[model samples]
Target chain A: MSAEIEDLLKRYQNYPNVVGIIILDPFAIPIKTTMEYTLTVHYAALISTLTSKAAKMVTNLDASNELMNIRLRTKVHEVIVLPSENYIIIVVQNPGS
Target chain B: MSAEIEDLLKRYQNYPNVVGIIILDPFAIPIKTTMEYTLTVHYAALISTLTSKAAKMVTNLDASNELMNIRLRTKVHEVIVLPSENYIIIVVQNPGS
Candidate 1:
């Protein structure tokens, strides 16, 4: 599942007039959670800035609740607004222990 | 309403082995909100640090299932987990606009 998303992101690089592209692991992803879409937008911006691509605009992450999460519970925090999303994008740090 | 909480905080100085004392405005209060109690606890610590009082201990805010908000809505965002507190201690910044 995560691999497939990465593959799709890679395809973004082949198109002409494209910018840099990278995928984010929503699993245990670190986020302020309530920044609406800024975090995702920033991720795209970071990708373009670090790589050689003619991209200056960020394509939106269509995080309309339908494409977030569907499995995992305590491993996933309580879904903040299931009325909005089936799965949640939780904020987790890199496992250090 | 807010005045009462401040008065109670002032009385804390009279008790021995107290640290700092300060009240928070749940309204338009700047907080990370999800820190559970750290932000509130820090407020007390900061108060004790500056004030000359026999306080080195902190108390808890009795924020259980009550004593929150009851009226505001859009002025308030949708209640996150009303399965818990009726009035949420929203992470609001000091209103400047």
Candidate 2:
């Protein structure tokens, strides 16, 4: 599972301005990370909270629809969250690069 | 304000598979909508909640970093949330054209 995730994350590296990638469990525990910069567990926890809450919000509305991907962009960076059944994949990138 | 929002929404029509757009207040009240399909207020409320939570999460981590844009993509549609100081812009588009 880890190897497959690492491979998948490598594919995104080709994209422009991709700073880092992190895979977290539903509880926001960091399962894997490719961050060159420091990414604290607190950050991962908060991100997980955000992802889970968003997923729950969507699910509550329509059970037929599934939540696939989420992206948050700031002036300096863009955060993309892809939530699967068991894990969440987070990609941090530079916007407009 | 509504005219500016309408004009900005028109700009997004150029993008592929852009089905609709909605501008909501901080509380998720729909200020404007360009949806040809039915989009309930419940959907907007949940989306607003999601955006606000995510913004708060990011702010808790780094005060200097501002939350700018958030995009959530499902199998059928892509949801992009652009949050400003007073309002949140929600754009719904079809994936892969």
Candidate 3:
């Protein structure tokens, strides 16, 4: 699983603006990270909470649909969140290409 | 304000995959929408709640940082949330190029 995740991160690294990537468990425990700094457990947990809540929000509105990815962009950075069955991948990037 | 929002929506419409746009007050009241279907008040409120929670989470970790935008993509659609001082704009789009 780790090797597969590393490969996935490598692919994302090729995309424009991508700077860092972090993979986490459902509980928000860090699985692997390509970030310069280690991600804090508290931050990971909060990110997981946000993803779960957003997924729930969608589910409540349309039972047939499921969430696949989330992206947040600020002036300085962009963050993408991808949630799967048991894992969540977060990619951080520069705002523009 | 409405005219300004309409202009903004028009600009986003030119972006790839963009299908709809909705602008709402901080209270989640619909200010304007360009979607085919009218968005329910409940849905807007839930979106606002999620944004607030996410922003708070960020603040707890880094006091100086503020959330500017959030985007979510599914197999069929993508959602972007942009929060400002008094309003939140959500853009819906098809996934992929």
Specify the highest-TM-score model's number.
2
DockQ of each: 0.01, 0.72, 0.62
Can you write out model 3's per-residue Cα lDDT over A35-83, one digit (the tens) per residue? 6443546557778999999999888767887888877665556778889
Which has the higher TM-score value, candidate number 2 or candidate number 3? Answer: 2
TM-score of each: 0.17, 0.84, 0.83
Clash count, predicted structure 3: 1
Clashing pairs in 2: none
Could you give candidate 3's per-residue lDDT for residues B8-96 as a string of tens digits?
77887888977777788877788887754445455577788988987887676567777888877766678888899878888788887
Q: What fraction of the true interface does each of the listed models get right, in terms of native contacts kept?
A: 0.00, 0.86, 0.66
**Which 10 successive residues of model 2 chain A have the least lDDT summed?**
A34-43
The top-ranked prediction according to lDDT is 3
Instruction: Report the C-alpha lDDT of model 2 over B1-97, residue by residue, as the tens digit.
Output: 7777777678777778788888877777887887633564766878878777887877776788878888887766788888887678888888873
lDDT of each: 0.26, 0.77, 0.78
lDDT of 2 by residue, A1-97 (tens): 8787777778777778888888877677787888733564766877888877777776776677777888888767888788877677887888873
Residue A95, model 2, lDDT: 83
DockQ class, candidate 3: medium
- iRMSD values, candidates in order: 21.2, 1.4, 1.8
